[model samples]
Target chain A: MATGNSEVVNNAKALSIEVDKMSKLRVIHYINQFYAGIGGEEKADIKPEIREGFVGPGMALNTAFKDEAEIVATVICGDSYFNENIDEVKAEIIEMIKPYNADIFVAGPAFNAGRYGVACGAMCKEVQEVLDMPAVTAMYEENPGADMYKKFVYTVATGNSAATMRKAVPALSQLVLKLAKNEVIGTPEEDGYLARGIRKNIFEEKIGAERAVEMLVKKLKGEAFVTEYPMPAFDKVVPGKAIKDLSKARIALVTSGGVVPKGNPDRIASSSAQNYGRYDISTVHDLTSETYETAHGGYDPVYCNADSDRVLPVDILREKEKAGEIGELYKYFYTTTGNGTSVKNSLAFAREFTKELIADGVDAVILTST
Target chain B: MVKGIEESGIPVVHICTVVPISLTVGANRIVPAIAIPHPLGDPNLSKAEEYKVRKRIVDKALHALTVEVTEQTVFEN
Candidate 1:
């Protein structure tokens, strides 16, 4: 009886251990040809291939994750191949990763290697977007791909070269664990990751006014003070190919000046608008005082209300169309109140409406803002 | 919003009173407005004068859209 009772106790302990092992988070690591033990740049054209278990820096990541997670597989591709055939390679790599059913995807601590950095960023982005999996990577701050993809992927900042691999691996692994376990991630300074440029609201012990006063005092004392909201580095777009001829162009009117029909029927907020309004002005040639007004609160409404065409010049655009200076006006106009609106919200609004503008074959836009 | 439209491969001319702000925001093509309160026209001017002012600004914006620029550019009225 005593022997039987001991056996039963041992079985229960074994079962608990098995349960714990099963719960270890599954991870898949991605690396370029060099790290995959393939030949150097010569092998960079090699196609993507998957291998079971850890490879290269992934071994360090495995150690960092320790018993909390296990790298189930490694997906290796050459930098040149990945970049040169981005769409195809991404699809193939995603397929390879899918079978693993990984909880997290980790790409290279790419360092300053531009091609490798791009590969890492691209893979991580694809995994996050397509597979709906948590993806993380490491790269130097100046890597061009870092600027392009950091907003979409969580990237840990590493030294300019692989000499920092020792440091990068642990930081990358820690972030992976936090994401896999759904743990709260701290600020970029605390988490050793690049800022994703996403603004999140958090409650504070003191009001904003008090914080501002404290910061002012510190500044007056010539002490260093950090701003709560750092200004964004705006993206500079190279101008698109110029319209060959204005007479043949179909121009569309868009505005952030908050000019809407007199009734403000869309109820777009006078400030910090959550959405944009699309109004059809196909039949209207001029914006008269009784027909249109300014919905914007930032600027005085008097002038714009007197002649809404001053804000959105449907009147002049019509004259241009009549004079054959331009092909025609697009039948509709898009308007939103830009004052105090978050960039994210603004982008979302544009993304949604631009599709329709594109589909309608609009050639150019005249975006007026106060 | 201007950036988004430009990024979609459509050329955009941002007409604003604040040229510096427009430049800082990375607008590729810009036309300066007369003032913040009345971007396209001076309200104090007579109706016909205001119409000419508005016409000139619109013409500049139209010209801006056609001119090929590789970088941020502000068109002089």
Candidate 2:
């Protein structure tokens, strides 16, 4: 898996295999057993198979590619087998795929079928990350795999079922052609794909304030306008059960309020923190102004710098520990700056520390944010 | 971070000045704090008074951690 200088997936990769501009690009298509003309659920356990040309939906994609590209091979795997033994199947599939020296990889417009969509997403992710080549897939936005794999694959948004196969192929093929030809792809709207939550800076004709004024003018006149930045989707989780007994439960303190040692030892960003700090608080009973301070840059830091407990609440929690109101305070506290931090990075930080908390038998977490 | 820990099956109470954002982000247990700069502190009061105030808010947060909640809930006292 070698990456070229271009880090942007939409940007043309540094071509390793010679591309004779006029030659028909070789394409590899992935499909499930059902699409390979195999029996339905009974044959869902069928092993991975490679064939000479296009399969079911591939027929439509092949037509869309027309003379510009052709499906040189079709790789088919049963949904059950692929998912159950994902790693084994992925390696096997890549070995099957490598011989084709294919220009691009394309997987299902799996629609709403959960397992199939996951397989397609998983395969596309593997192809992109392992082969270091562009891969495309299509699925409904609500499909489980779409959320899991959309960031890794340039997923073409499609309707909920195969009934929309007619509309999905052209879009998928267009993106596949662009990747295969190493052409620059455009925005999700201009190109027919789902928003991958990737940001690309571009120069515009108008200045920021001018555009904002124009958009405000349109809004006042009841005209439609698109927002430059869209909020990331938030997932609602089923809350874990509350502690049965506070005195018996070990508690941990974590914060986006960014309380670190006095000198900012870890060098965490005062805003938009790319990393978090886990400081040992077991030896320290209280967060004194001389020992600890706030690193967050969003609000006035004077208060937090004076008493870091205002944000982390370490002192009161220590008092509670002495009173046996709580079993004990965790020795370490996790912290990061909340200001200007993306939801993606925040989620990543939490997921990483929760594993350690779980291992340490922490029963509950108190999170403070400014 | 609150959502992450909670989703991983550890009960978590979020202490933030922005209760609406906590609710919108699906935090199961929420505790409204004093202000943006100091979530648990009120600098206007004397040191002893501020400590008591911080203690009260923190006590509420601990209680919120112990209470059973079926959906997003704000704990304010």
Candidate 3:
């Protein structure tokens, strides 16, 4: 549920293409629970169904790919398909869609639903393997599906909920059209999808060997060299509606930008941390002692703290609370090391923390990132 | 960081040294500062100037709490 960078290159550069040189290929759409027009939670086991034409985003896909490919059929299933019945469901869906001459397959702009994400990842993997066809899916960067299948398919960061379906569909559809037309996708950002371990042989603007030398020189000089392919914006994130009340509400301060204690007392790894623990400071307000520290390696240490105050600015937030600028600060602030944290863990932590916040009667939050 | 917090049904005010990145990344509310590393104040500055910088950004963060916009926004002093 974290906010995402909005600096995204949404539209691809209109590269030259011979429209007549491309052939119309068939494409298939896959959908889960909600989009299948099936009920949720109450209808978790409604079984699978295959239908011709668009469901949910299929109409949008049809519009985006109208000139490039035809979506022959739309396949719908409960997310439980791959999760509960992996082998049977995969085999059945493959057999079901086998009749269509699908050039590519598209599953969710999964947003951030955990079960739906896993289902999309599994189904895309199977379709790629069994049918030997290219497939595309989109998941939020924080979705576990991204880590599991990003290397296998073009996974875009979708908004965590289906509300982003319209925004998510266009990018995925455009990618499929380009794939069908054999159009060169310049980079992940330019192309609007995740890189699927497929590297294209492109001539460097400067000669190849010279490009390498230039990069080496920049590295040696410690210049802030931007990578050739900038990380694409996970702009598919839909900012949830803002909380309506703040001044009268209980607010908590939280951060994932790895603001921890000075000496790394928790022994949390500098990157790829698996465990997150919170210290209880009910007796004292600020995390000022030497016992607390940060484990994030992405930034310089001087500002984070010799004392933990710099990273976790609970002291300032508490001060504001005492002055009535905000409602009472929650007793304990939540924290996690954000460096290279997997999307799945972040989502899980958010869900868990939300529960705690609710139970504690906290109404709003002011999160800081360093 | 702000997205997750906001999704938890809370308002988050992001304070950053590099303001553009945060705003574009869809920060609903933002407070801009002098530089990326030391967002509040440059350690090289005198105490008075540093305090001024910190206070300005902090004030912007607070201001962000009361306004609304559909797109990402950063507050400048």
Candidate 4:
């Protein structure tokens, strides 16, 4: 529940999209605390709130809903608060949503503000995954969360500011009804959302390599063909100063080779991995077939499964640790399968676990790939 | 993973069989290895020989961590 002391922001502007008839289907909307009439950055640490009925931009959304559905509840969280304390906030929001039993969830047309966009994306993705319900969010095509969640959720494309709310409402409302009614979802062009880059498997006239070259030709000519993976602008990394002493530095092993304790208890994918696993190796001196195996599918797993040390070199590093050639090996190793995994997911996994590495005082890392 | 860890100011050496792929993905320090399936081990050899091969590759990766490279550079093994 938003406090009465909250001050309304830019959401009071008139939007043209409207409908007179009340709808039956219930919808839950998500917006940042600022849009809930909470103050700006200075007050961005406010926690989650469930306000009964529409607030701010949810008004325009309600107009769009018209005869199909109505905004039953609005969930608001500060952008910073949502991003900084995601795990806790996510669980809290899920609990808040359970009582409403809303048919569909809609997050912000977040525009170009990065944190809000990511929050909207994260909320929509979580709703779909954990609640097993349809969810949608709108944001600028270039929003950081666009590439990260576009494949996992439906995201309507919007302009770079709240001014586009009018145009955004109809498309978002339309998607809400479509999802609520269990209607067929269309291509991005037809539905007014960003492309998900999900390729359908259909027998083509040409082989893949030949078709790839053909796509290259079409791309050069600016002809019509579905676009392929676009490389994101990679961060320019400043090289860390060389480790000054081998005997004293804490060395850690991280891998994209996907070596795990036998049976891979986490069920991490053998290819196109969606998650990473951290395993404790405090007592592990040698990797054996009975104790470890490879989950990577892009290469022969036999060698790695026979001796997981092949991919991780744990046996050698263990020896190095004992001989005082290097400092102690970090107790946990992070691993994932690199096969067909998206760069966006890879970047996310790294961003998450690297924090743990730094917090644990690991001085250096050795990353291996198959 | 290599570049991400490095960006956080922890030096990382990427050990992989494909040096070119490592270069393309922006690992500052790289170490070449044996093959895709067995980056540091050779099943064709005896246990002692295979261990020596693994140790050599691991030693090079550790060495790569201590070398200051101005750009993406691979330390061959």
Candidate 5:
């Protein structure tokens, strides 16, 4: 009877081991034509295709994954073709990957290659959305595609050249396993991924006041200590060519001071505005107290409400037009409240209106903020 | 917002009370204002005097737009 019990226990252990081996996480690898060893730039327009198993870098990935995960299939597409026919190619790739039942999708450690980086980012993003599975790729920080897609996918940071492939594969494999296993992900700094600009709340042992005081002490002592919230880096723009002849320059007025027509016709938010208003002042000469008022909520708003021109300076700009100091006013002035507004939304507002300004032959803009 | 307009190839002069904040945000051309609450004119001044202050700032901004600059520059009021 003791011998029978021992035999049953041994059989149970053997069955569990077999199950573990059979249930290894399945990964589908994606690569561009170049990485597939099909050809370089010449074959950059090849249509999407699939191979049964690991290709090129996938070999390194598979070795890194070892017993934890396996590359079930490899999908390859040309850079130019994928980008040009993104919608069609994405659907096709999704269909191809569907049969593999992949737990995670991994794309190229594209490095600084522009088209290849874009292709990798696009593929990873699509796979995550369509398959409802975790997807990851790697690219250099400065790759334009990284900026565009990092928020949507987990992009591991890679060096500028493929020479870093040795370092990249292991990191990529580790991230893939973490995702497949449904483990908690570390910060971008810890996991070597690009900062996704996501704000996640976590409990800390120390209270907020203690953390603040500790940070202050460290700052006062000139010790290097990381802040809980870091300021975003602002983009520096090189100045455009100056308007040489002001008398021939068509000027326009733009404001973030929240100076809009009275009664707030567009109903732009007093704070954190999502939209900007474009009002025509072609016939109007000045911004009178009866006609306009302040919509901004950040400031006292008393003075601005008393005289709207103090914020927008339309009265002065109109004077300049009449005095021939400027060629003409663009007729339409763009205004929005900047109070508590996100930089992203502010950029979007300017982007859409600038096109109209260019189309209207505006040469210079005088932008006001409060 | 100033950066976006400047990046679109239009010369822009930012009028703000906080010159340092404007400078840090990379405004290529800047003209300082009197104060934050009333950037263009000082409420302490009489109506006509306030107009003069507003005109001076605007005049400086006009001059700034015409002056060629390779980097960020703040025009005097």
Candidate 6:
């Protein structure tokens, strides 16, 4: 074991890895059996739980993520997400993450430990796929999950054991920040994101059409040309179900996909929002500066914050409500930030929100997605 | 949201311009609009066109509320 040196916190030594300091990013972290401060082997069968702030290498991760973002939430689960009751665990953990506002997600600094690596790889892939978000996890090059899910997510190769935790976090953090900025990342060799067994364009100097044409011409002539764009293919979410009826059902409008007051007075973060509050607009025609405000951070606040009713369509729905075209429109509208939102968290919110609507006898929903 | 509401045992009439998402999330009834960002009306268009689009889609969504369907159905606008 890499002993003696482990006792002291070496934040400076940990962050000494060179990186593009210009990029600013926000990040969410995921952890496993030991690092969650959970006892390993003894606690290998641990279920998922939510925690705020840093745990284990999370301190190093925070420093690594400095100027980039705060590590908003640290989700901890065991290797058992696959070995034990996988489905329930995934669902439960996903539900746990719905409320936070985040720009990027990171899982494991899973060193060389095989099971831990697999766990990290799987979790990162699941997050990236289901949430339509960016995710990264680190594992030893030899971990089996590395082979399985590395192609799907950003899985970095690492040395064996916790001794490498310092090295792992910075490598993963750099890639994660680049992801948040929507900047092009190279293959595993260049950017440290697990190689997807495919190469993509990562332009060094120029961008857009002119560069694209130059690269294309080089490729056509069988000459070497570094591409300017390397976009990862996203898995399409299977569409939402079709509604049965419209005119007769009492339809209500709901948006937590961040419909807010124009000024964003509540100052909600786009990806990892912690606060969720419903504004009272019972007496107002449309949400105004004094009447209602936004806590959502998914978009440019000016438009939605100035007129939240536009995003929620409260006025329009109210107009429908007055006509008695169908039935009563629920007065309270739910709100939350959708940027960098995780599937686990969103579903949990959905289940809770469903209960509220049910009790109120709300018949239907007309949700707008940004 | 409509699909989520319906999953909780209430009926819903999902209004979306994105036909694919509406169909898959299991919304019981759906009404197609012009585009994604503005499902009812295009903000850039003339008021007449906006109203024309909104009136047509909104009418379909409202009408869908009255009808019963065994499976997912889209209201043609």
In model 1, pairs of residues that clash are none
Better of 2 and 6 by TM-score: 2
TM-score of each: 0.53, 0.51, 0.46, 0.50, 0.52, 0.42
TM-score of 4: 0.50
Cα lDDT tens digits, model 2, A103-186, are 889999887555577789889889888888788999887665777788889989998768899988888999999989999999
For candidate 6, give the lDDT of residue A213: 88
Give me the candidate number with maximum TM-score. Answer: 1
Native-referenced Cα lDDT, model 2: 0.85
Name the runs in model 6 displaced over 4 angstroms: A1-250, A261-267, A288-309, B1-4, B16-28, B33-37, B46-52, B67-73
lDDT of 5 by residue, B4-73 (tens): 7889899899998656557755789999887666789788899899899899999999999989999999
DockQ of each: 0.26, 0.30, 0.10, 0.28, 0.28, 0.11
- lDDT (Cα) of model 6: 0.62
Across B1-77, the per-residue lDDT of candidate 3 in tens digits comes to 56655665555677654343355345677765553334455567675665555655555666676666566666665
Tens digit of per-residue lDDT, candidate 2, span B1-77? 77778888999899987565576556889998887678899889998999999999889989998889998888878
lDDT by residue for model 4 (A1-370), tens? 1543232322222122222323378899999977888866545558999999999999998988776788899999987577657779988999999898889999998875556777888899999989987899998876666756788889999986677888888898898899988898887889999988775665768888998999999989999987455665566688888988999989889999999999998989976689999999999999999999988764657789889999998899899999999998999999998865666788789889999999998989999987
lDDT of 1 by residue, B1-77 (tens): 77777788988899986564576556899998876556787878998998899999999999998899999889995
Candidate 4: segments with Cα more than 4 A from true spot: A1-234
Per-residue lDDT of model 5, residues A30-113, tens digit only: 999889999864576689999988999999999999899999899999875776577899999999989888899999998866
Error of 2 at A297 (Å): 53
Error of 2 at A151 (Å): 0.9
Per-residue lDDT of candidate 1, residues A157-269 (tens digit): 99877778898887888999999999999989999999999888989999999999999999999999999988986578768778889999988999988999998999989
Weakest ten-residue segment in model 6 chain A by summed lDDT: A234-243
Output the better candidate (2/5) by TM-score. 5
* Backbone atom clashes (below 3 Å) for every candidate: 0, 0, 18, 0, 0, 49
Give each prediction's root-mean-square deviation over alpha carbons: 20.7, 21.2, 22.3, 18.5, 20.2, 19.8
Error of 4 at A23 (Å): 64
